[model samples]
Target: YNIHPSEKLIQAFRKKPYQGCCPIQAEFLFIGLDANYAYDIEEQKIFPKVIEYHKDAISFWKKYNVHHPFLLDGYKGDGRKYHKEFSKIRLTCEDSSRISFIELLHLPTTGRNNLRNTDLDKNHLKYIHQAIVSQYTKAVFISDAVFRLMKKTSTFSWMQDAREIEGYSLKVFHETSPLIYKHLHFSTYGKFQAQKEKEMKAIHMIISKI
Candidate 1:
């Protein structure tokens, strides 16, 4: 019997837990060739669908080879590896009551270039974004100005009258390094984020000391 690729992920995560940055029952994005898909920045678009309910599931990471981690040569070719990485992250960070939601209100306008200083294909990114919307409810996304830059042929179109998710708060920042494939970098955005949080707490400690 053939199982849906997604259904397989769901069943696996139920038996274990996720490690690293991915959230519990939280959705993610996958972008690559149709034959072997993975993750990309476009996955942020699915943020609206995941806020109300919590369930057990695993979302695929865009695969990368160990030989040339930066080049998009081939899929990692190991579903079990994906499962293990996610499971370990989930188990390690089981106490997440301290985390908070942050809305990327400017993504539709600015795109990933709004954060990173690189030009990327908007259509490819849109494909990844669509996948995210299909998976999770409260995923992060781009602003209209950012989205305009990612387009293929047209100049730019702003998504005016865009509405915010109910009961959600917004936080805008000049920089955003996401939590995808962060394990590859020597010091990943995940590490940097943790450091930033630690620094903030340290300042608080100093303030209390004074």
Candidate 2:
């Protein structure tokens, strides 16, 4: 991973041997984990909001007239659309109902009005990337620097902060030890793992009770 790759760097990351019983976006959509669980949104492999928005049922282009012009843009909803009963990953756990690729705690980044072009002082690559990585990401006004960096690095690898949780009842995705280990890039195995197992068992008991 250290080598400065040729033009094929992105293609390299995208190419992974996938043979699962379930449908994975990684095969064609370039959605799947290089690691166990995703550390960042890009690694999670969820559909890019704007990318999917342009292709969805809405077409502002055909609807737009000269004077009256409008277009519905990317991921606009209560987040229930992506909340599939069965996505490749598990954001919402085994409800047999609220299945999804990754359990989203916040809104997608595309919905908000981020830094404007006039607001160039704060339009930095790292800043923008950080702003959009949140589960409740309002919007990502990607700056030219961000784009250039990706192109230059030939990598979309960005910094990601694991979601924090207040408790350990599978109450949150990133906080649960087993779930995190299963679905996130972090690890839970070590001396403290015993406590995590106990907590997981306790949660299972709670689920059975409920």
Cα lDDT listed for each candidate: 0.27, 0.25
The runs of at least 3 residues in candidate 1 whose Cα sits more than 4 Å from the true structure, single-residue gaps closed, are: 1-26, 29-119, 141-195, 198-210
Per-residue accuracy of model 1 over 62-137 as CA lDDT, tens digit each: 1211111112233233232333332322221222221111111212121112333133345434434443343342
Report the poorest 10 consecutive residues by lDDT, candidate 2: 21-30
Worst 10 residues of 1 by lDDT: 47-56
Q: lDDT by residue for model 2 over 1-210, one digit each (tens)?
A: 111122222232223121111112111111211112112333222334322322321231223211001112322232222222112122112222211121011112223223223322122323323323434322111113223233332123432223435553333222321122112111234685565455446433433343
